[model samples]
Target: MSTVQLYAWGPALGAPSIDPKCVIIEAYLRLLNIEYTVVQTNDPQASPTGELPLIKDGNVWVAGVDRILTHFSMRNQDANASLTPEQRAVYLAYNAMIQENLYDCMLYTWYADMTNFVKSIRPTYAKLLSFPGRYLVPVQLKNSAKARLAKYNVEITSDDTTLPQNEKEEMKELQRTGWHHMYKLARETYASLDAQLGSQKYMFGDSPTTLDCIVFGYLALHLYPDLPHGRLRHILTHEYPRLAEFCERFNAAYFSREHDVSTPAEDVPSLWKVLVNNPRGFFSNVKDDIVSYMGTDAPKEKSTAQIDFERKRIWSIAGGVTCLLAYIIWNGIISVEFDGEQGDFESWDEYDQEEVDEEL
Candidate 1:
């Protein structure tokens, strides 16, 4: 059988991938002792679902961590095979809690929190992209994060002086209320995880399972990155030291090798190589990225103001490009040059005189 190919976001800050989902998938593969070559890419479009941590084995392609696990299950490689039905039920409950509550907290800290977004998140993603993507992707990710949190009534807001005094007060109150709720959720979730872990090495007995991988994935991101506003990290480290210790041990066991197993250097594609091999695909991905960045992936019922704003933004970009091209042409930076020899000509008076003398 051919070695499986794992496509994920590039690693950063001691994590296999900046994305927690990617980290979970990588850890699961390592835990299973699967022979897979990691293919690092910044483009989420590589996956059919337009997400990361995809796996390609022979003719089969799996886009998500859950679906990949299901794919593995068909081959009798289930990670939670040893778990009792009761334990599996527990795992599902905790998993949903983590995904619903803790994941939102992570998103808020990394993207919605302006301090962390500007200081850590944006810079991290910026390094992974090329050209305009460096400027665009971070903002898109931030907007997506905010949109995801909107349903939870969580938001990050800055004081808008343009608004009326009462409106400004309302916004400020909403910001405080939202973050307070988020912090509370994070604290409660950590406490529950810590209580469940107790002194056990793994979540369930000696062997690590899918739940362990998921827990570690979230914990590692919180513990590893040195974010400016690090509220989630603060809660985990100070309030839930057991969870913190679990993350440390987990990291040492799976990720502390001299040669990193998750991202093999040779298997990773270079930007130039991707462009050369599939230029059309590469630009198509870029266009998709730009459209996504513009928040086209948000809910279909956009406000009229938002629609107008997007239209103006597109027109502005087009106008800017047009102006740039016109400037280049007008300044002779891009001009037509003739190679034909030049013919010398006399003034009209001299030509007339010469003609008269010839006639005489």
Candidate 2:
């Protein structure tokens, strides 16, 4: 009976759907009775691996939600072990593809409501949110965010959920007029999916599989029930009942863990949009990205050219898996040295030995 350390995340942005991998992880761990700790992950900026959720199993470090969940199933004892050998491999491959595809569509569209997002989902966020509006979620973001948040709160939550007449009408107009392009992209994708789910139980079947796990989380956290804040107001729980039901069922089954936000604040997950596809391949959040969010001009030079090398390397490794087999074969993950300078940990555990690693 060994245990592993799972560094998880529940973000404050109140992205109700949040992380699919985490949802998968939660269901697997509980079903398998795998003794593990459910904790928030570090801000990617401060983590050894820039993304989460990360799982530490002895000397091995696995990142990304899908990667970590497979790590759990592979090495840990599976009480029921429903996945066949072939099935497991296929699930891994498909999960990666779908997750990336969804994100590509999502990130591009998320910024459209970059400002209006505050006014849309105020009720769900009104609780468990920390950080004041003044310094919260960056600056240029504050004013719009506050107005939107306040408006959203007023709409969804009234003494009896009776949003004011003017308030309702105003929100409706904003949806049709303001930031509509972004809204269309973000909402239409789900509208199609929602349409497709007319009678099915899951995406492909009655029984849930890996794909179901991903879809459930993605839709719940991002789609379903509502649009991103204020931009896509046309789509709401009242707008799409079946899809909304799907989201509710998925969350009830998967994200059932107590997301008690206060303790060990570091465990919560926060996603930052980075300009990773830069020409020179320098990765940075760029001061401008947060300047509006933070209401301050970015430092004269806040580029992460130096610190971003590792991030670039990791991303390059991931991107090359498709066509650059040779690059992967020769430019492997191990170390190479011209002159012998002490470098490269023999294993992932040496740098950060987890107390949980001992149990596992």
Candidate 3:
């Protein structure tokens, strides 16, 4: 017996409902022939964190797509459904890219840009920023973010309630464009998926892997756009027919149940593609955002821990103090690059890599 249960959500009415997270979990479970149950994520107030897509397995509970997929992957590993070693590496890489790069972009759109977004989504929520302690929202809004960040990690008190009008305006501005960046991320991520799917039917191969499910759920929310005024007509379903086909196939085969209230399985295909509509041109454009999303906030060369290292390097280099550290910091870097077309260099001895660094 499979201990797995899926939590799902969708539109309140009108549109055919689909939750990508639910579909991804459903796909992997069925493909692996694992047993599981499904439920709606319960909530009296609709918070950004999750009202849907939180699953409970006995005492162990996890929310969001990544955590849910990880839980199920740990449990199921049949040969037909298990990821190949090579596929496993790629899956991890892709999933990481989605979480760090794509999700950062998504949240920046959802949280940072979504004042208007929040308002647009307000109907979905039972209440507004009644999210405990409202005053700090304005404080975080008006000043240079650095000043407000001082408040971060500290508990908010009732005294923080009032804010200057300007900051309130700023907060509203951030909310307006939240969806734009996500639209950018969806295009970029979808392109990556299309390229891979065009190469092979499944994300990893003919058989779907745990990675595919992770990629599928979040993308579905954006592509399907069951929400009014958010549907992505820009990502023409014609551009990548195969990916659309994959989504449709999953919807039809896995979710087409009569009793399901959220999204009818019959409409899964259109709903699936509609969520993450475009990718080819979109993914290629956000090079800076992607790199920034991956990197830490510390300076590229200097860090909080080694502030003195830069000062020491500058003094040594300028004042004719020929210290060993200066040379080590500026003199050299070691790198190896390979092109697949040349030949396979899987082993160390084959490539002759003698690695030495100038010691400080």
Candidate 4:
């Protein structure tokens, strides 16, 4: 049998990938005892869905953790194949809850929180890129995360522009409200998961299953990374020791390879070199970002209201991007060129006069 090729984000904090989805897929592969080679990359363009943790088996490419699991299931390599019908139903319910609730908390910690982003998340992901990308990609990711949290009616902003004292106090109050909401939700989730574990080695039984892999993936991120404000970690370690122990045992069994499989450091090229050497690839990434922002390929199973909401989101994002670009260019933070030269008009006055003369 040919070896499978797994393309994932670079490793950090003794994990295969910083992404929980990537870690889940890698753990599943190891649990199945599959032979695979890890390809560390910082670019999501390697996947058809413009996401990480993709696999290439023979000539077939599979993207997304769920899709990869389904791919293996078709080949009779399912981890949960032995699960009874009742257990399968429970697994589905728990999986949805974990992905939606716990995953959002993880996002809030790493991206939504300014302190954690600056202290840990930014630096970890920055090492995977070079030059301008090292500076740009992290911000882009944080914006995407903030957008996701907005769907849950949670808002956080980093608008540091000068304001009146009263306005500044109000802004801080709003941020505190958002933070408290996230903390409450995360605490409830940990308590529920702790009660569910209840002295069991795994979530379901003694042997590990798909649910175990997913749980460990999220738990490892919460426990392992040294974040500035580790509220989630504190809760798990102090209140939910069972879940902490589960993570330790799971990590020892699956991730403890005799030979270190940590990704070797590679020299990433500067943004300029990336654009000059691989212009097509660079534009491909831009196109992917636009498509992701628009979300036009959303699942057809969505309701009419959901589709309409997506349409509205697309228009709003388009307008926001336009205004942001205009602001940046106007302030000389970014420059634009036409015909391989900077535009001749230095100000709107010059542009208006040019238009008037042309009309005359």
Candidate 5:
């Protein structure tokens, strides 16, 4: 009998949950083949600690992904129990990278890019809410995300006008520089992951592990999402093909709903290659980053709505001018004395004039 119920944010954009913590914990449960029911909710107030992705077992509740995983591990024994101490250390390090660094990058990618937030993230509320609830909830979530990013020294602006006159340009420059650096850092993390994943069937090899679940949570979102800002996605799919392959391999094994598991040739970088390429790229990126810090990337183009508004404004002005000129001519507002009857000018449209004349 299943007595455990997992509470998490509902699916959005075809994902099981937009919350990585929730997704990872769910993946862990699946990996363990545990029987549990999911209870989706939008309200954080429903949770024991006012945070999401909690698990309820009988009368006891466990809050948070890490705590929940720990609880399951203590009860059922960790999937990573086979990992040696040194391998476990490496796994923990990568898990931390996903949780602390990659998680923030995901948030910034979703919230900082307004196009994505409006197009994909915002509409998610309508899936589970209505009216003002749909409107207010997304705003609250976006604001909360911004605050979290700010805590990590990531600057976010809801509007350009919110900054001071002189500081607007400066802040924009800073944002561009910061995002480029942030993306670069994310790439470095992926490269490390590519190296770590190697030819192993799992993170440590042979069987699935806790680290594999953690990595899957982050990697799946990075690869699967049709994000507005896809720098990280491109890097994952192209720059680190091995990581991409690893994701595919893992997906085929556990997530694909098939029971067959096959070991494929993992593209692990050689020791010399890692030693050479990593440090060489580090210093090169450092030099490039210094130059990047001194400058900014080009500003993004106006969104579709903004561009449409500008186009409409231009057409409106042109139409208004044409209407004014026609009004003046029709009313004889700009007339001069002529050798012809003034009313004759109105008969230029012969078809309409003939019809009116016949009616008269």
Candidate 6:
């Protein structure tokens, strides 16, 4: 078999990888006993999705952790085979919750928090790039990040200038209160997960599963990085000691190789260089290139099972819409009545005796 090559952000915190998505992919590779070479790149455009942690196997290049995992699992039927149908459902639910909810909180912590961005994340970028790049790239990325947060309506830092001074302070207060609530929610989530884990080695007992890799990626990345806020560190290390140990164990077992805090930027083709050289050609061909290599369109055709699932999904949505429309119509009809002496007025209850008598 041809070597499977993984392109991801390089190691950080003495671990194989630090970017949460990269960590998840690397951990999955380790769990599957797949020997792969890591091609570290800081450039966002290195992957088709403009993300890190793409994998190339033979002629195939897979982007995103989910897609990469699926690619491998399709060949290795035994992958996640131990998980019963119920367990798989639980795994998917938790995965979505973590990816959607917890990920935003993590972003707010690292990017939206000016303290962490300046003291921690900024310096790393400085080391990773050269001259104007060190300054320009970080600022561009930070601004883009803030824009994303604003797009998502996540709480903004006090430093944001989009609002008036008074409103900025209000936003900051809201941000603080929101973080507190988010932290509490995170604690509860971890507590539930810890309870589920119990004294077991993995999330589902002794053997490792894809879910374990997913959990480890997020938990470990948040805990290990030297962010300005010690809240996550304190929670993981003190509040959830077992979870902390789980990360440590996984790290030791899988990423025994020595790795660095930053990768040399030279390895990645500069985004500017690609744009300047190819310009229109680069943009035009990129989608086709990715599709050709991936051997599928943006979304591949669904199997019979998947088709059935989608059909059920469509019906479920239609049913929900139907019920909601019926409810609105019923409420609208029941709430008001016409009268000759009085203009239209509210009838608070459909079963009101007076209204019933008047109707009769």
Among all windows of ten consecutive residues in candidate 2, which has the lowest summed lDDT?
Answer: 273-282
Q: Which candidate is the best by lDDT?
A: 4
The runs of at least 3 residues in candidate 2 whose Cα sits more than 4 Å from the true structure, single-residue gaps closed, are 11-24, 27-33, 76-110, 114-184, 191-198, 223-240, 257-360
When summed lDDT is taken over every stretch of 10 residues in candidate 1, the lowest stretch is 351-360
Candidate models: Cα lDDT each? 0.69, 0.44, 0.43, 0.69, 0.62, 0.63
Candidate 1 Cα outliers beyond 4 Å, as residue runs: 157-177, 258-360
TM-score of each: 0.70, 0.49, 0.47, 0.70, 0.64, 0.66
TM-score order of candidates, best first?
Answer: 1, 4, 6, 5, 2, 3
TM-score (C-alpha) between model 1 and the true structure: 0.70
Candidate 2, 99-150: lDDT as tens digits: 6544433332232232233333332332323322112222222233333434
Winner of 1 and 5 under TM-score: 1
93-200: candidate 6 lDDT, tens digit per residue: 888877665565566676666556656766776676554345444554554555655645656442212222364664465465366666776788788778878899
Predicted structure 4: lDDT: 0.69
**Judged by lDDT against the true structure, how good is candidate 6?**
0.63
Q: Write the per-residue lDDT of candidate 1 for residues 75-136, one digit (tens) a residue.
A: 88889999999999999999889878777888877755655665577678878876445655
Clashing pairs in 6: none
For residues 1-360, could you state the per-residue lDDT of candidate 4 as single tens digits?
878777777678556578888889888988899888787766665554557777877777787888999999898998998899999998898888888888888888876665566557777876886544554466567667777788767764431122224645644744663877887888888888887788888888788999989988888888878786677888888988899899999999998873224342232222333333444454455566556545444344544643553455456556645664576567764356676655653333322211110000
Which lDDT tens digits does candidate 3 get at residues 41-120?
32311212323465556556665665666676576654225656776677777877765554444334333333323333
Error of 6 at 21 (Å): 0.4
Winner of 4 and 5 under lDDT: 4
Report residue 74 deviation for candidate 5 (angstroms).
1.8
